[model samples]
Target: MSLYNPNRVNPQRPKRIALVIANPATSSSTGWPVGFWWSEVTHPYYVLTEAGYEVTFFSPDGGACVADALSDPNDASGYSRHDLISQGFLHTPELLARIANTTPVQDLVSADYDALLVAGGQAPMFNFANAHALQQQFAAFHAAGKVVAALCHGVALLAFTQTTTGEYLASGKTITGFSNQEEDQADQAAWHYGWLPSGQSIMPWRIETRLQEIGANFVHAGAWQSYAVRDGNLITGQQNFSGEATARLMIEALGR
Candidate 1:
């Protein structure tokens, strides 16, 4: 019997990973520019690429992407000062250029990739909530027996995604997203501290509540900690804090 060679890299047929990001949208509550969380994309992109996987970035509307102000490691607010992973990733000219330019997800065929990772930001609250086309892409990956991962606010899309069988993706599955308590705290602080507008919820709806409405077994690890869960090919991380951990879990599921 031959032992499996985990280190064997198939240079001729390298696996492909699809990184899904949301197109630019304004925060309805604060009118601030919104895009993706820097770490949510950079951290995972770094992990998967370092593991020798050929990764492609995409967005529903296509074109370049932006980072949420709070998620930018170099932002003046210093909100993400602790996010050195993203800071390091940003310093790489090649990777930084990739984020500055992304292909349209609509241009990709589902079968070309072995996995899909949806990145998070304040934008997903608007884009993913009712994105029928995006739901199809997420469901197709699951139906094809591929590893599919989403962390933080990106997981909000799962609340609206349904399998081909017409069941919600998170229905009867264990998952996590940016929690309601965390949202409340962040919103309150941003308001009280003048980081954003005051007196309204940052989002019109909550991720935790939406998942529960669809009967998801939602799990939380409290504020600002790494917590990720894997159920078969489905992987989810709790929040921005769980980005790299979630990517590793997805990589493990991909058997890489």
Candidate 2:
């Protein structure tokens, strides 16, 4: 059915992609350290690297970034213990090395790469949303018609990013991201311990609500389900589980 064999071949001229993350030490409303979601960053990282794409990591403010505590495989909460790939990556120094040397947005030119990916986590609710600089950068990439990708809370920026034409980049595009329902489910599941909700409401506005207001063709598959959508070169994932799926789509769209 599919020509892709995980162990099979390699490409001589791999595609180049850039990854954007939030700066470190920013946390969620519940006080969890957050920058980028683990699966959202790592699964895609692993996929692109294995496919021979040259991937570079960057941050909004140019500094070290941290994953949400729940994303840590070794975390006492074990929120992410179920992620084998993350668990494996947690133990690999070489693989983890990229997170140590992330570049700043000023250091990158969108034209240098074939695609750009925005990662999500709790921190995005605080840092990425309403980020004028980040929106402008994404606008540049989107205007150039290069592949632009965002997952989970990272999708929040779509509501503010405007293309060179002064229109919201996603003004008429079909996309997907963490839905209101999923946020409710995750929040309801963690309420026993007094963990504050991570819903879209945290932002003065919610992602689903804002995206809809901006005329985005936003879709949702269901609670806790992996859902990713590609509208032309724009790739988006709904939540953590959708990260790997989104990465696979990017690879396909890049023809790798």
lDDT of each model, Cα atoms only? Answer: 0.84, 0.79
- Encode model 1's per-residue lDDT on 1-256: one tens digit a residue: 1123354387666678899888888877777788899888878876777777778888877788888888887888898998888889878897777777888776778878899999899899888766677789888889888899998999988978998788998898998889988998988997898877787778878999989988998899898788899988999988988888998897788765
Evaluated against the true structure, the overall lDDT of model 2 is 0.79
- Poorest 10 consecutive residues by lDDT, candidate 1: 1-10
**lDDT value, candidate 1, whole model:** 0.84
lDDT of 2 by residue, 97-129 (tens): 768767887778876788989998877877776
Query: Which residue ranges in model 1 land beyond 4 Å of their true spot?
Result: 1-8, 196-198
Clashes of 1: 0
Clashing pairs in 1: none
For each predicted model, how many residue pairs clash, with residues at least 3 apart or on different chains?
0, 0
Best lDDT goes to which candidate? 1
List CA RMSD, all candidates.
Answer: 3.9, 4.2
